[model samples]
Target chain A: MGGSTVEPVVRESVGSAPGNLAIASLARTLRCVECGHETRLEVHQSCPACLGPLAVTYDLSTLRGSVPSDRLSGRPRSIGRFAELLPPLSLPWSARLDLETTPLRPAPRLAEWLGVETVWLKDDTVLPTGSFKDRPASVAVAFAAAQGHRAVGCASTGNLAAATARAAVRASLPCFVFVPAGLPDSKLDPVRQFGGQIVEVEGPYDVANRVANLAAEAAGIGVVNITLRPYYTEGSKTLALETFEALGWNPPDAIALPLGSGALLAATERAISQLREIGWIPSGPGPALLGSQPDGCAPIADAFDAGSDEIVPVEHPRTIAESLAIGDPGSGYEALRAIRASRGAADSPTSEEVIAAIRALARTEGIWVEPAAGTVIATLRRLREAGTVRRQDRVVAFLTGAGWKISHAVALSRVGSAPIHLDPVHPDLSQLHVGPRPEALGGAE
Target chain B: MTTLVLASVLRQSAPSLHQKEYDGFRGSLLEFLNTVSAEGGPSFRGRIFDGDRLRRYLNVFVDGTDVRYLSGLATPITPTSRVDLIPAVAGG
Candidate 1:
């Protein structure tokens, strides 16, 4: 029951100044990862001081009063509406496509099935790329373009490449996507549709990631996950911000999130702290944060058990949830700190649980989800059964991506009917297999 | 033709071990471990030539068990042995 404790909440301010590009311009400055030394952003992905990854700094105070409830109503429908909360975007708003603001629906049936009250789904499947990666990819690409970087790339399992391709194509930035060949075609099709330069690496997800650092440095390409990480990660904060605002400004008792690279979980925790500090929302009882990962690649979960902050790297990722297939997460340490600080728990469910959860969501909630989302929902069920989440708790189960995105896994679930061999004339009979089977067929047999 | 290879995995069921170095794996093992360290996430401060400082939950397995049980990094390797870096697949 002992989890993260509430610490003194601090809010970094982004000064309020219209037409004052100070906050936006400062994005070019890069801070050292190891020593936190501030300097000009490096062309190579490596930090000049210790070869560490560089993070972008933001003027959060300027954004303090910039975002109001109705501010986004008339603005473009995307994460940019909360632009004041993010790194300043240099490109014209139209040049950068808006891909946020999807349907965040309440999953009452799923909640009832899990026996938890007030469950909400941050349905990101409606996103242009059908994954939460679009939130970060859009911001990262825009930041990269603003910095005058032409080409962009990323090492992806499946979702990141699709999101990056959509962002890159819209921005006219030629994109190169490196992925492990083991990825299913359903996830690959969207990337190619966006004209991405796809490269299939021989090894696992980690092996495909090798080219990003060098290319980001040598070619000055904006590798979203690498060079633009600081700004890119800011995109995930919107999920927390929007979720709280949407729920009548009331934070949930617990947030169940999918953990892969750990950016989403870390950002959500940061956003909650930031909102509480600004007085926009009163901070009293902190919500419990729980992270879900596939039992196959759960380095953070493993480290937590060992009571170690250091993350172990897994050679191979063997999970149906390919999007969450990151064997090693750069932000794993920060994720651990945040989860512990929030007094939250971590769960890694087996592939069987992941599959079963996926079926349950579609059946009860009519919301189909990919394996990562299934992992969260499934773990939420397990926790409920274990009494980790009480029946009275206000729980929100994050459905990160659409079931349509990872149709392969859904097909494997076998809960849905197999392809019917009906001819064009018999299309009406497709529904015949549903409900009670017609006695006519039985009698004919 | 022949090169030293090492593989290790961390699991509760088995202790860590490093076996004898074998042929045709020196290049692949080194590349896998080194590249896997940075891009795969978890930064190890020590230089590759200096030696490996495996992260907290990291388990290097030559065939099945961890290298800690066999000989740490000094575990012997042979061509027939397979090396693997097992991620901590921890969950209840």
Candidate 2:
């Protein structure tokens, strides 16, 4: 074990000058989140010392008092605006595809319903692939290109496959996506449309992920969530940045987001901390980060409820919220830590609750969202009822995916009456039954 | 002596490696893995450890908690401790 030499997993096909130059000025390092072991800044999956997830650490001293509010405002409305804080990427803005900034709309009706001071919907349904996954896919694909990888791939539930496929096509890189069998055509069609080679695995998402990981290591393919995870996760921080910027660089009182792998919630917390450190926002505990999951697959929420650091994996996840049906969340531990540290609460809404919340949000705010986003809405209502979220607190719920993609899953409780047929050329007037006309208001014809 | 429980997935790689007991194994997790590899085969070694460290995709549990969260490869194993090697399974 002592003398055996292990070959480097990721080869440097391209020059590291760009990555080195980017981080040279700033004090940045990759550190293990669990054991604090320093890892090399490369396309590695996990820390070599602890085998735990690795996160990028930035020295915000240089950024403090330097990033003026107006300077950021003047930049393009994209994740690239926060380039100073993100991991180094070599692709220029002109070469990369635009992952547009999503709207942060104020939901007055939702606020009134919750009895909160204000509620803003961080609507990510408007993203390139109609989900928040495009945020990370954009950065990850660009990173792959910079690293001179000719191909990119990932194991996805639904949203991520589409996002990765679109990004890969835009970057002119061959893409391979593995998803579980029996996935709906709504999610599968987009992957094919974007020229991704889809491999349908026989088992659940976890099995698909395992196969993807094997392919990644065996073939040296750049799997966004596996090999290039360290850089890929950095893109999600932009969600928080966009929210803070929308609020005039002020952190909200609380934020509720749907949790799948828990990466989004954890990354958002990371962004808040970084913003505070760089003096972009006031120095205080940022927002209380609340996490929501589907009841069928709520391992992280269960651990949070039990007050245990260990997350027990659900063997068979069953849920209408297909996007959030991750039984064994890779980022569960980190997400639990973030939730506890922020004094936040995690909740898992039942399938019925999720569907109802979807309808409720659409009726109130005219924002149609997928079941994953519905989980957030349902959790917010629960928190309000439980007195965890106060009436005066400014809350923001993250609407992650578009409703149209999953329209088939939302069954209407009542079906409308069949349409009455009428001939186009010769209309049947007898089909229309008219009652006696109402009397004139003033007895006038 | 300490008993090591191999996950179902690991059985495919190491046919002979199951719930095996090893005597005079007072060492770190890395050493225990190396000892097993020496006795079992190279396939077991390749799947379990990357060089001297446990593979990033595999989880080693002492009792119920993950060893990576504890002390990683340096975590000690005693006769009273039960070691379980579980393949890391995650949804995308």
Candidate 3:
């Protein structure tokens, strides 16, 4: 019930400025995802004609043979590195938040454990906001500022709130964030630190989102994920772009990612297709885009498994992975289409499996990630066991968030009890069994 | 008469439909929408539906269950049932 009391910003009817030559040449039109209606690029949520989500359509002919390897390498390591492919902005690369070029480290130990030829972990956990949402938030906040909006906001589960708050601070814009009541304090602390006006809705995330959308519409405030989504979602394409660049411009055979709202997977597929269309990548099949979700609230996976085009929303979502607990994913239909288009699969693992994966990834690859990332690791194991992913194929699993934030969830799963009370002055050595050192026990050393 | 709840965002466009009653209305969701459209007039109709189908971003629920998972446009509504119209919420 704790809501912001700030006066609503007056609605600014800023029509789409005639885009710069660079943007106008590449971005052709905004196409409706449901009804295929085309319109000019403007500040609006869904299609005016059909109320379906609007997606950007580009004139790829302008990019033909334009982006050479040197062009990409010469640019600064940021989301704007592939400026030719992304939505054009007047802001310079240096002014933008540095969120791209995350390290894609090869995990030989993980590969060996999984009996695979090669495995690479795209470490997005090291992002500025400690999650991949920073990429999208950067683009969205910049777009909002460029459109002459003085403030920006969003409805977030956790990561997006932090990402949006940080990006808003970078852009020097007032930020408001609406989050579900009772979100983990660890996730909420960063938003407060970033100077965002936090509004906690007394309901699930969906209800909060609805409240945000209404506020945005009535107040004319730019809600990044709602009003500026067409431009905001474009930022996620950088994930695929960065991955290809790190792999020497060669697409992986398969890539696994956690499925929340399904925007990241949809954007990754678009990135791959756009790269191929622009002749940046060779003409061939792109990576199989595998998606994973927690079994408790896996509407997309359930739809995929049922072989249905319709995504049935879960009335109530229950899972340890709060980040991936989106019962009704906004991009569910598009995500399913991308998965099928790439001949990919979707899996939903149980809470126990996810916990095991979180431990396994930390032990094997030295990467600590939140439970959402664990969904991908667990799904990859399932895919390998099902023979859908071959031993010879190169796989990349995206680790999306930092584990330190969700350390409590991990400890609860691992220890299954409260901490043992011990007196520091007179500690019992029997309870803490000391083991022989590895070097002393082994003969080879 | 069924009790209808419109999301706060949709109130401006269809204020007449907000917690308004439709006495003796009985049929599928489509039929109910048609009745509301007739009573509220053209602007309300256009905002809530595109022809016979609900707008893509708008979701309808009968007694807390999404109509899409039920019978879609044909999902029936009782006189005592409460209906909710909400926009598709974004997730990350």
Candidate 4:
């Protein structure tokens, strides 16, 4: 019994601050996680009690209207279809390039293999930046412009930098991106293409993030993750909206999403709940919001089983899926709450399994996904095997990004299309050898 | 009572102190300051402190928003107002 003793993990206060100040007329505010203090404006760091993370408070209680299916039919292929859900702003439609209504295709083949009758993929790869980060960055950058801020910044891996730069460019604002020096070239190229002032620190992604936050603060720039976070995350709710609408306004039985900052998980839950509140869809047993993280960075998953409401920070993130390589998710605790409230579970997959899932997606579904999406798909399969997801239920998997953005990870997965060795040149009709026969090419001329 | 000076933890410099008094808040960031000199202390609000300088990734919030967005170190606080600091802690 002495050998079976369990060690205690100290739960440190999870600290968070508003991404930015809330405009008073916006009717939204920042809420203190420790003391539940609601304020129209604030300019400080850390909470007094327990020193927990703070969250943006919105008046979703007064929400109204269902997005007429046709209402979104003609918007540009951007995250703008759900403009009503975003903060009020005025900009040319072209400048906005909203992508609120991305495609949600059925994954019945995947479902059959996983023993599930219904499944769908919320494909965000086609977004302008080739990842779901574009969704939030679009809104965040738009809000920045609405506030008359000219420069937009972020602490990013690859996807957020790309999205922020693209959105800032579309809005004709200067963009500043801070990313780690070791970030994969595949992710960094897009950010550079957008003509952003890239600040590549020599340290890890966390170190780069530190520099970005400080720069944003000192320069008073509108950092998307720093100040525009609340509004930025609001863009993610559209994923849930589009998911339910694609399913005829009915919630799915389960939703498996890749966990990075945990904002997506929280936003998805709120979207489903809002659908019920606004009468767009009748309230029913909502989807079980399962989150998938790479084994290398599964702190939230660790906390879930530990039965704690806090997170223990992990340094030196080691995952090929750099998009989800966040070591300390600011919203991890909140994501835990969001999942538990929805009666969902979270899990992590090994790097090998993630790679296998990526290959499977490419071969079976004709969709090439990065390691993060692979983690989600693999987790969905695991849940099916564990009976957490029923065979007769509908499962919706949120594939956050495209494979092209992080093709380096996929290439490193040791999975490739069948190779075709071509003749170096058509030298004298294959050097006076075969026409198309393998044997004729074997002649040792 | 132990006064914990809360300031941004910059990459290389020490956590700069801002004030000496509690400012009526539980964790007084002021007590962490080394001095109030222009060049001697850490740089914040156009001033320097030799104590714990604000970290680069860290953002000091009186209630949640960055002090830079308000009046920097000069942002007022009440006895009940909570101060928070945040760094871009990714998942793991």
The top-ranked prediction according to DockQ is: 3
Q: How does model 2 score on DockQ?
A: 0.17
Better of 1 and 3 by lDDT: 3
Residue-level lDDT tens digits of model 1 in A338-413: 8888888888899999999988888876888899999999889888988988999888877788888876787689
Best by lDDT: 3
- Candidate 3 lDDT at A419 equals 63
Question: Compared with the true structure, what per-residue lDDT tens digits does model 4 show for residues A305-397?
Answer: 677776655566788778777776767777888888888888888888788888877765688888888999988888888998889988899
Q: Rank order by TM-score, top first?
A: 3, 2, 1, 4
Candidate 4 local lDDT, residue A240: 80
Candidate 2: count the clashes.
Answer: 0
Q: What TM-score against the true fold does each predicted structure earn? A: 0.75, 0.78, 0.84, 0.74
For model 1, the chain A TM-score is: 0.85
The sequence of per-residue lDDT tens digits that candidate 3 reaches over residues A1-445 is 1222222122222232211122222566778888898888777676665466678888776566654554543345766556556665554322455455789988877776767888999999999879998988887887788788978999998889999999899888899898889888889899999999999987777767767876776677789988888777888888888889888778889999988888889889888888888777777765899999999999999999999988878767888788888887888888999999998999998888888888888887788899999889888888898898899989999999989777567775674445667789997757764587644322111
Chain A TM-score from candidate 3 = 0.88
Summarize candidate 2's per-residue lDDT along B1-92 as a digit string, tens digits.
58887754466667576778876668787777777788778877776777766664576777655675578788997766778765563334
The alpha-carbon lDDT assigned to residue B92 of candidate 1 equals 9
* Lowest summed lDDT window (length 10), candidate 1 chain B: B4-13
Error of 1 at A82 (Å): 1.2
Name the docking class for model 4.
Answer: incorrect
